[model samples]
Target chain A: MNKAAASNIYDILDDLPLDSGQVLTGAQIAYETYGELAADRSNAVLICHALTGDQYVASNHPITGKPGWWERMVGPGKPIDTDCHHVICANVIGSCMGSTGPASEASDGAAYAMRFPVITIRDMVRGLMALLDGLKIERLHTVVGGSMGGMQALSLAANWPERAERVLVIASTARHSAQNIAFHEVGRQAIMADPAWADGDYYASGASPDNGLAVARMAAHITYLSEEGLTEKFGRRLQNRKSKSFGFDADFQVESYLRYQGSGFTQRFDANSYLYITRAMDYFDLAEEHGGKLANAFHGTSARFCLVSFDTDWLYPTAESRHIVHALNAAGAKVSFVELSAPNGHDSFLLEHEQLDRVVQGFVE
Target chain B: MNKAAASNIYDILDDLPLDSGQVLTGAQIAYETYGELAADRSNAVLICHALTGDQYVASNHPITGKPGWWERMVGPGKPIDTDCHHVICANVIGSCMGSTGPASEASDGAAYAMRFPVITIRDMVRGLMALLDGLKIERLHTVVGGSMGGMQALSLAANWPERAERVLVIASTARHSAQNIAFHEVGRQAIMADPAWADGDYYASGASPDNGLAVARMAAHITYLSEEGLTEKFGRRLQNRKSKSFGFDADFQVESYLRYQGSGFTQRFDANSYLYITRAMDYFDLAEEHGGKLANAFHGTSARFCLVSFDTDWLYPTAESRHIVHALNAAGAKVSFVELSAPNGHDSFLLEHEQLDRVVQGFVE
Candidate 1:
């Protein structure tokens, strides 16, 4: 796949040094721009996409043919209004959405596949910084992200405080909890367990690990929704049937919903990318990066931080946001935190939330 | 594979009718008895095992060579006290453990596999009732179970009201919630997704869906533990290493633990049984069986009910137990409900807890 020809690619001038002490040569970052940048470039707002997200933040997704994931919040006159801000959303380093990922060709003219260096949230942030340099935007007006994207936002604030004047993180954590790591590990195992996976060398085999990846997606989809939300939305409702089938066919509405989600995901996403991106998330520990103190990560940072969390987001609960707020407070950084009530769990950030829009608009403006 | 020779097998004299309207021509109920039945059979206590549990209530598991799952709760002078009560535990139908399940021989002398009719929680209770009748026990002193086991106890109380005088349900729900069904569906999909599964006819193929089953177990294992308990137990700790492997190995201790759990489970469990059992659990909705009002299930019941829930058992939380308690209260039944503090989540029922032991001992004695 020629990623450079498909999207706006910014080739890094130097070798990209990774957290694992490996170097990525001739790295190309794929990104999409929503609005024009100001003459001074101070109006630029860099948006980091989540694990499964891509560069299409305010437009239609090229693959899915659906509206951009954050289209509701990032269009013209919207919350992160493209009218005033030059919105730039980048496909993260380890992702396969036109980015130089595992599916990308190596210098040896073969897909890197499993040879792709294990990247971290910080490494992803470094990639973003390189993209920013390539675009000649020395400082972003704000850095905005949610979930894995939010991790990148925090990483930018900690590692490159001068890159952004404001930072907004939603429904994310500074470090992956033990449960979080365990869940990711389960997903990784599922993907690798597939015979079609071929130890991540399936790109040339024409047979992807769709079964394992679908199962992995199905498992992850449950964690994205609150129990109350699921109960209200699905309950024990039968799926287009009068009664239970008493067989393995999707009898419940939830089962049908999950099966759809699992199968639909395999179409637009790469299985190897799922492995690499989830690995990056599991390795994300902001405090560990700074000498055993979370506050130290934000030392001397001038970026005004606004952290938003949902009450029912058990995946990255409100406590995680509070932990970041506490760290920011200890570091004496300008910070504001809010735990909004939402029925949709961790996916609340990507959904239609008026309160979240208000917070993002208020903080960014 | 010889279930009859290995355990106390009671071949049902009559055809066993299932909730799905399917009938088993030759059904066998494998059970283990502790202590002897009283002269009037009034001292009999029937214990139903949960998902993945067996009839080895107070003895070692024959397959795993491990101590009985509920050995701590049922023994000489233990909580249930086999010294005074003739304890009986039968592996539920649709389960692999020496019961007439998917792996069991069908009427034509071949493994049922996917050919086995789908069974429900009520269906399982019916098999238990047949077992009781075969033993010439008119009524039991108590019917006790936790998790899926608890579901069976409630079913017996509702359907076979005169079979047991007392019902003790722990860490279980009267209905399978949307979230519950969703998780179970993921597991079922995981197992079915494996190529080696071969539509559940792998009994003759000699290749089991261990990878798929392991992944399924790994996903389910997370729900059985509280986030706090996981943090306290593993907490991002590396597994026998000083630092992250930066690769697809079990780096964290929780990953290692889950991997161990997943692999160990496949060794002792049949993959087809996992699919059938989880499907049965997903189909379990007591209120639906009783015309949408949970209280209707317990109407005119004479059994004394004791409901126990753990503070951290998110799978079947205290609210689920309270729902049952409310229904029992509305029915004007003799019922007692307690929500105990435990950090182990849904698996707390299987873990040793002093409070639980005391409650069981006091209630039984």
Candidate 2:
């Protein structure tokens, strides 16, 4: 089957209310499912994706022709065990992957573009809740996520306490820090700075702000990897050359690698979507939403929470996970926390890590 | 005096050879001097400036109309003791402020731009040495620098051991880490991605890549600051407004601060100069240059060395200083190393710190 046939999109019958005081009508959510749903829907596992991620959790990516981002973690007999559990990954709103986003048509049959209302993490979770309601799955076996995905998982646990029985958050934060917001702001500025952006109305111009988006991606890419990991992987080794070019070329292997990442991202991701999604993440503050106490967000929650953090993930360090664990403890929730030693940093969640796999399998089972 | 008069430009009377096998003729070195030189010239102290620094080390900046970048540390009663020592700080060759850089006029009477030969840290030190020779000074006292300036100090100590009796390197690494190169590459790519950049020939366009350059500065500025410092200073604080605008305005204080920094940087710095200087820093590898052994770089050195690093500095961490100390020990050189506790991160050396002040005073004395 082609990408369209393989992808399942759910159209919301009701208008979606956003934190920005705006309402979204005719919203569509794109998702992919693996395995079969149990008769009572008790074996359904909902997976949320991070920024630049989509719903292809355990299948082939239609755009890149690469395996699902979490193909290693979620498959038949894998950590998530698709053989026994039904896996569902949804593309959040404000994204361009067949979802109702800036690129999507409004009631007037035109792209929303800059007219799209700003969204929050809670709003994304609301969309997931709506998806669950549409599928007639009252409660999920588990809600799994990492990074931005983790934020969504936490949001669901906090706002819709009865939606998921288990919450698995990895390398995530309850709120965006000043540094995190600053990085996202830099990316937003980069995308807006490109003339080709045309104020996010470049859909009909047959041109997009690829260059600015690429630069933004490059900056964000650095934060995803540990310094030691980068040193081990690239070092000061020249890129396909014996000596430095002494020019503007990518002389170092790290430089070449970053360029590839920056450019490759532009192909599958939309610049406007990047801006909107990052903005949503920056505005994420669970404590603020719960009367300025993080524990209050998890009040009366019976969900079994498992939080995993990588020792080297500076983007959302172990401290962040510890903060959440403390909040969960104060809420008197049944929670398990672990800081796994990993060299890959914040991206360790999607990369190969036997320890992480073991943790996921143990927690899920 | 006008900025031109306050800035002293020295014309090198000889051709300068560079590491890239390129020869530069008619090189001009701009400098600012403080205090009077002793009759024996033994009281002369050479202060090397960092990547974006210029000759106005202890004086008013020509372009910014602000105090000198090092006014806090280089006055008469300061650590360097300008009262007893003739202090000289020269702008690096690849910088814009009154120095021979990519913005300078070529022999053909046009801006060198991208046509300028790529330079290295050692090449910058060579320019400083030539400036010293033109001043009829043998550099008897010391060479003090921080960050990129520290690289130049180390380079001078190794390549021209007889130039100075003491070398003080603060918060610096002997070589660029892979992470460092990656960040620099992001900045460079950001600049190059701008259509206004015009392949570095934007000098005559009346429109420089300010947007791209600003984004680059914003990205680099993050590395100069510690995450803790950012949190303490601007943790999720809104900018001027009580609530987010729900739009692409600078809603957060950190975003506003970054935009201010990025935009302010472009007003005084040339985009081409930034590219050249950053490229020079990335190519710096003291060990690779000296027979693949860091100890060899300091072999037979009679110069007294002192290295200071900040505990919060992730850019050039204390471990980097330790590495240098280890090599110095193996080379049988007299070296003292200190990692000061500071909240400012890599920019700690340029900030006010009693401990750093005491160390500088104690070492220089």
Candidate 3:
């Protein structure tokens, strides 16, 4: 996309709703579309990302050399079948990328900084709805995501039940468990603790709080895998030597992996976006929207739901997905639940697996 | 109890072997003795510690304003009652406390720093042998520990099977899992990345890697507890606030908890010590020391072994304890295994619980 087209999303900000008790207004959301929109826009599929993922779900990251976060499941001829489905992957509000968030210009044209209103997951979905309106999409064929993205899929199904005919949530929970919120809190604190974070006014600060962000990533990365996975992959082996020099060094392979994860994450991600996104995720509670009853969220909703969970994903776990399934069943909503066997934990949804691919393709189609 | 008597242990180190082949041995090992050493030293009980735990297992931490790490399970009226068993809790080798570790002085009377050797669980046991000889403790009633300390207990039994009559391994594994090592590596890199580390010679420069050490502790601390424990203690609830500031601050209770844990840890703990201890833990592998035969680690052992694991402890779960139990059973050893219910995860052994307490009390008795 050219800078003019990308910047067009910024210029049209005034057309979108800025306030509804949401912490921020004039929020900019960035997105990308793949495949052609079918006549009537009925073939459109919306893809939501996890806390750190953005609109580049099927493309190479501009800064990092790593592949798109969800390329395994969203590429052409892949699960979501770009050949048959018009896929839309949008950067959620309160995130960096091309999206308008705390780092984006306010009405007066200054970066929102700490002044950005805290956006909720529902607010993000609202922003996405506006984006869809801008794209002239009346209704989506499906809404799909894993982890935090999965949460969004459910939120879209609950708050705007008619937006999609099918909703596929992978490795996600309907509500942010107290444990989930606690872990996210640790990551946010790590980023904020960076001497350079400058109270979320980091854009003009030149250098970001890379160290804190790195630590936060390292901490979150641990929650994304199973203990068995860690054992099989990097069991306490030394780094580049047989003997330890005994000083502060990456003595074990696991420590080295975490450091690499943390350090590499700083390249493409924004610290403020991280803080904002995590807060939004933490504040998300679908059950709270429907008289504190989870089943009520799906009450009378015609959207067909498919919730996928990896057996090893203790962070969200199969149980959390089952909770959603149980709620859906209680509401008598059409939904299918599968606990896919995967050793990769919560990250399993992002990786390439024949079973996961088959499941996503069948569900979305 | 007096300083003069404690200083005598330092003089005896000269008679011990110095550094050789991946082991550090140029300094003294700090320790505490409870109950009287019976005649012939037949009642001696050697207690070990986890990665960060020190010889102050049943004493006060000088900096944190807290009691010993395992005081709940080791003091008077506790499970490992000092009123009955003669307990010897020693700071392991590769530790900062008076232990002969990398942080210890070399023969040149300067901190070994990076020159400290890569020491293993067996090597730590070897250092203990020297301490035992100096104290003239010929035989033991039991050897006990949780996590890393448990590894040392197992190592003692494996290396000198006849010396220990009973062994209690709690929340531990015989081998380092890949994930375990990976987490440690992340922490080490966090410390090393700090300019204050000064290539691990921060000791001479008087500018220690406090930030790195704090970050490392923050990461490792998360693994030491179960999600249930963290959620129970610190949920998404903000610290004395009803709403998030949307800035880089302690917006949630967990962030404040982690920050406190990180900053408070830097006070008494040395950065180099954190590096050395974690490295030792990473090098620990019972089977590797016994000519690659995992069962050989306990070959011909007559010691009664009890391995206790917590169901929520992913770090070293019941499966890991069962792995050790299977090997012990295969070796024709008297071994019992118990999978306890605890919300504390890997750190359950240190918590005040009748289940773990009863197991240790009965096994030791």
Candidate 4:
């Protein structure tokens, strides 16, 4: 894959300060743009991605050779409408996709691996803001995100209120709940437990912890879909052969599907990136950052807000979106909230929905 | 760990047949009895345990030196009161803890390991039936179970209707759903993915898939508790630290608790047995065995059925119990189903509850 066509890299020559009291040196961000920047540069929209999602929001993924995850929503005439607006999607800093993450290099030219400074969602937003600064975009027409992306959007609104004129968050939460942290912890533990992980230093060894990473992906993938969705999609159906295998060999169709997702994910994702990104998500607490009041996060913010949640998105449920809306209301911010009905869970944000399309179209217009 | 004080072994010298058309020879079952059988041999109540539970229902666990799992609900004057009835709890055939499982010895004088025949929930019931036959018990007054144990109770009532006069199933389904199988599959994959698992042949090598098994337990453990319950109990609470560790260590209290649960589980549990038992649960589909009709499973059964489900038990939700109730209604059988409000998710059966006690007491009486 040609680098120019795939993504553009922006280098932050100054050391980027981190919340963990560590400074990241030679930080870089990889981003892709869908539409040309308007002459006034006031029509630019920034799109943030979820965990495991990359900057290829409207382009083909280089490694997977598949259409972008949100291709249906982001192309011309789509919900995101790349035709009229300048659309940009950047790989989050702590992610593997051409970003300055654990898989990136250190000053000594060695892979950072576990040595990379632990970054929070705020830190990731800071990286994106630097990218925005490099592109000479003074303010975004809209900043839209879902799940972790939503976390970043909220972070941007709270920390840098004037950066975006409009903030759209979907299927996301103001903070990670205990259950949320617990699930992510399971994935992290699974990755760490694999012998091949080599304490997150497996990059030099040339053998990634594919098994552990796959298992981690498998576990996380289950949470992304609703139980009803899984039941409808797979049921208790067998994988290939009829009847039960009576052994531990992916007997059920869901097992086969999960196994496929896990293994396929390993081919395109780094285990260390999984660790860093999940950790960042776990550490996210907008209320805590704003001194124990969620409303305080949105205080003195002039950005118009739009929040959306899916009925089946238990990862970050409708209640979480409502919680954010209440905070926005308490802060006296102009915000619109909607809970869409979708069979898919947290993944609904990435999937097609007429209501979501209309909402985005209206909000952006 | 005296044998007499802990449990008794019942040997079935005859070749025991499995649903898979395989024969298991020299099968032994480890069981414990609380209180005494009545003169008419009709006061016996068979208590089935969930996954990871053993025969020590109301007594102390030999390995962990802890009170029995169901001690709160099974002792004198408690629900399933041992004072008024003979309570029999057995470690299911495909389980560890002195049962004939993957850890048990084969005729070749080696641990069966993966060579052990894949057994189903029905096969486990068959082994229990053999144990009852050896004990010269004409019938049990009641057959009670929760979770995987509930699967066995349903299996016993369907396959051998005359074996028990009453069937009590709690927090379980007649058949595992796609989501159920997916979760079990995750656990199995976690175990098998471990290099130490050695394809379930790690017994002779002195290394077990503890890490994988622990991860499996951690994942499954999350499902056993409700989201609200987890939030109430842990809620981003730190683990013996002032703030986030900013590293891969357990930062949240939930993560710390899960890690402890995972690591501590390895000390007393066998990983291969985990695989076998979960496979058995996945293979369970009452409708499939009953001519593609759930009602047919209870067609000739005379047992009074009592199905209990916790409102918060998402693993085996109230709808699953309602499904069984509908089948019982279709079969013209007397059935009582109740969705108990409990905060502890699927673990409500083992916890103390006045309502559950009333139901168990009234049903058993």
Candidate 5:
């Protein structure tokens, strides 16, 4: 664990300033970098991860070895091409990665678990900014992300406007809508229902809260895809044979698929981190930060803004993007918005949608 | 639990033989009679119940002591007016209600659990037919139900066209889609996850798969409502909170609502019945029984069909009703379909909807 010792991102990211007048006294952060900054350091871009995403934005995740989550548009020749933009992706503050979150150790060498300060999106952005400062990138060319990542971008534009020149958000909203927060709450409850969760202190436990975590993931996973996508990909097709079993088992392929997704996720993610990240998102209310005027959050913002929404993404629908456009217009900020048609629901921003790709490419380039 | 059931106006039923070749040993059917039957039994109307509903269509539930689920739509002067029609509702064969199902004891004086023969919607209709035969009632009037109840209605009309003069199906489909089966699979998994499920044999020991059952109900309940409904009623709004606590609690009101729904459901409903009923619904395939031709199910049918769908009902969906309508049309059967706007989603059929009331009234009248 010490081989990377001094170079550990966690050591570098500990002790972040928090909103509750307390410093984040935990571990370091995990991150990845792409492209190169100009002499003015004005070309650096910070990409934030959403729930279940991390520092592997444009590279393979170390543990899972899967392609970086946003690899489709964040590579050297992609939309937020590293060749043109010095991009940086950091795992959020309250995440399972090398971030100072619930899974990390406390000063007393115990897993933080519930002891970690409940973090907000603002807190995450603050930590990211600290990382930027460490990298000597005073101002960024742009900040971009989708879903929770978009929340971070929105947070940055509102709380720290001078940190970027442009901000692009996709498949996200300025605040967690009641339904969105409700979904997260269900997921959290599912995780807690597992006996192994043990009040979020499962580090020394004999087993992981994998079942609860799986249920939580399955519930949230439904919101990530459109009914149309599910139907088209896996309709009432049986998992094995054409005959019905007439028993309580996964008969359809979709059921098995959802189960697999949920179960597989437990291996790489932490249940406590799931609770923390979701709470952070639910607590994110730009209007509240601006004293109840949503527009006020972006008032006097110099960052050029672009927002993208998917037509079928019910989780964070286009209406949510429109609301942001209305607020940005009210704030008189330079902003662009587009709602692209895609069947992937809130996941379209991370999938292949030529129009979305074009819009993001045009906006970021 | 043994009680003499009443005779009904729509008691013109036949205990049609089961296609599976298994005689339901020790069969006991529970049902309710509403209104007065005409001398010729021409006003007899059969009402089916959804997944968790029962034969007490107008009476009070013995467990929750709540009014019959469809009470608002039925009764003396409601849409399915008892004054003009003889309403007969039978507990489905695979349900917990008095009808023969897994919850019923086996010859050994033990709960059937997984031992009960896997039944289908048609099997349920067949059992109702048997109950009707025992009463010596000849049908004329109509058949009706929503969700799974609707499936039974369609099954009745398709398998025994000459029996029901009119079939009124609301928020239903001809066959359970793959997605439907998938959701049910998730639910069954949730129930099985509980240690107390004890391989679905917890009944004799006075143990219940409460946690697993609750999670199942929570997930299914979400499907019964629309996203718009969730957002409008409980959007990101915290349960009695001005801000989030940054922990994994039911921060949003909707989460609390779901938890309440899940936990409260365990108190009255049998977990095994949930599995059995959902499985029966999923196994339903009207076309499969008639040479893979949906139209063939209604071939030479004398029954007039009315299908009512709620626009927001993603569970059964308007498209599902449309498919059935198209099938009936192909068979040259008299059919009427109306897609009504309702925010309640699949459960909308059971709620207050003027159009739904008008549609059922006009069709049955």
Candidate 6:
């Protein structure tokens, strides 16, 4: 488990086919790994990330200079114990962090930007499959992800059934709901409305649609946490003042927090990547791809499925997880579904939870 | 009861004091009335509008060329029946529809724009009070409103308890929670981030921040409807297409509907007014103005209170209504609370509902 050796980037020169009827050539995928691949390659676990997450799963994020997003659950003695399992986390295609995305350079040495092909959840999974192929990993011990990551796990399980033995999807859905598409559309519009976006070619101008991206992040961030969580964390409490500002400044703690989150995100993420990734998420519909019957997506799957949902995660409610479980059941797949109690909303998957830890540990073992 | 005479503007030359310690001079309020005012003024019912709603009430909106937002429940024989009682609806101050707002001209013959004073829900209610004074109304038989309008009703009953005989607040809260403020902050950020906003002075340039405002509307519109409503109405339906376009165009029906709502809003609504009104809603806290005790706000008020909430209205859930009812009960006030079943979310108040119609009829009677 050498940290330096575990984290690296791989170049896939093969022309990757896209759902948009285009091909992505000379694509690069940034990834990080923990522990060591067992001789039989039977102990490798692939962990997919959420919309704003990257390949820094169990390690320090190079850009943010902070611990990985899921550091609490995926370190040395953590539930995703690196000591017992070799964990592979990749920055999905259509993302900013060193992966082949809108910000990535094209074969002609230009940033793909708007020229990047529209990708789907299945396309992202295909990228992961390519990375797996390069690493010569025959199969994954477990494919685990939450939120968008859950979508990727579900996509991998459905499209490449033999790629994984166990599929653990947490706080995710088989398809994007109307409300989901609506919110993502809002984010995309916000980004595109920015003049600085310059039709996604801002890299040459040294300016980014930071303001628009910030607003988009702010909107998306609200959906990640529950109302109760926000109420408890910030409420209508004033920020650095005794009374209301009665102006446009961030007066409330929640406003300040959201502003900070929004601005802070622009520094580390690309706005065009935000557009591309969100579009992929919006286009996710495993059931539609499999003939409008969710069960058909898993018609010949041999993977055991584990679905977890937080009771307060309104973004991907327990009902969504239940829907996936129903599909697995109809497909005659071995599956376990649980609606865990968590006040943190859709972000419960990344937060510390003893029960979730126990479940992840037991399932992975 | 002449439609032409009922819809008109009232100008108050006197300086209107605001909660921000600022004054708004030469303020104008646009209003509409249904039916004839009783000689004794005992049959007058003040109907407040939510954010984005205007004084059109039971008549046609001059701009949108559509029926009044709540026409379904405010007609001759409908709930809040014009035949039995005179109804007054006013576009609150800081709004655009013929009202004194950011879009209104200042004393120096320039648009107030960002120079307009930041207002609160209380400030809006104060303007209504001025309108009532101009009309020579002593006491309204009922002060009724939903959403932001509910905040106005609560403000009126709390600050000027003797002005109304009854108060009906629907799907609203006594205060804006952290989540509420967060959403408003997102919308504001979206509007302000648009380069076309040009620091709220886009009017003279003939280029408005329609794109930014549209995004704001889209985001806010999502909160107005329930997930169930969205799913039922649109689901994963495409917009006049057989399958996904695999591009960023409005691929989903929900996206198309939201885009239409957003763009259509720009033609009739002022973006700066949206910023001001949402700010007012964000600043709403009845208890804060009432010495931190919610019950104190209703102290000695003779107005019978009626609070209605829809079960699916997550924006302002039943719990918020229950909180207000508890305060009324503690104040020894006559209060009726009901959480009705509706899949329409917070916008249920403006939609057709027989139960809501009956409730309004019984309460007004």
Q: Which candidate's DockQ is highest?
A: 1
The digit string of per-residue lDDT tens for model 5 on A1-365 reads 11111123735545677875668854466677888778878788888888998888877766777898888888878878889888888878778877777877788887878888888899899888888888888888889889999999999999899998899999998888766776676677677777788998888775778888888888888888888888888877888877656555676788889899988898888888888888888888888888988899999998899999988898888888899999999999999988888887888888987888788788878
Candidate 4 backbone collisions, by pair: none
Stretches of model 5 off by over 4 angstroms after superposition: A1-14, A19-22, B1-23
DockQ rank order:
1, 2, 4, 6, 5, 3
For candidate 2, write residues A1-365 as lDDT tens digits: 01132479899989999998998888989999998999988999999999989998888888888999999999899999999999999999988887788888777877888998999988988898889999999999999999999999999999999989999999999999999998898899899999999999988788999999999999999999999999999999999989888888888999999999999998888899999999999999999999999999999999999999999999999999999999999999999999999998999999999999999999886
TM-score of candidate 5 relative to the true fold: 0.94
Ordering by TM-score: 1, 2, 4, 6, 5, 3
CAPRI-style grade of the A/B interface in model 4: high
Give iRMSD, candidate 2. Answer: 0.6
Instruction: Give the C-alpha miss distance for residue B82 in model 6, angstroms.
Output: 1.5
Instruction: Give the docking tier of candidate 2.
Output: high
Regions of candidate 4 where Cα sits further than 4 Å from its true position? A1-6, B1-6
| lDDT score at residue B179, model 4, on the 0-100 scale | 80
Q: What is the fnat of candidate 1? A: 0.93
Residues A31-81, model 3: lDDT tens digits = 777888898789999999999888887877666656878887876788888
Which tens-of-lDDT digit does each residue in B1-365 have in candidate 5? 11223423233233335556665666667788888988777898888989988888788877777888888888888888999888888888767766767777788988788788877788888788877767666675888888888888888888887788999998988887766776677677777777778887887676788888888888888888888888888876778888665566676788889899999888767888888888888788889889999999999998888988989998988998999999999999999889999887888887888988889889888
lDDT of 6 by residue, B1-365 (tens): 01122358898868999888999999988898899898888999999999999898888888768999999878788888899899999988888888789988888988889999999999999999999999999899999999998999999999999999999999999999999889889999999998889999977788888998999999999999999999999998999999888778998999999999999998888899999999999988899998999999999999999999999998999999999999999999999999999989999998888899899999998
**TM-score for each model:** 0.99, 0.99, 0.90, 0.98, 0.94, 0.97
The lDDT values for all models are 0.91, 0.91, 0.78, 0.90, 0.81, 0.90
The two-chain DockQ for each candidate, comma-separated, is 0.91, 0.89, 0.40, 0.88, 0.54, 0.87
Error of 6 at B107 (Å): 1.6
Return the clash pairs for model 6, or none: none
Worst 10 residues of 4 chain A by lDDT: A1-10
lDDT score for residue A230 of model 4: 93
Docking class of 5: medium
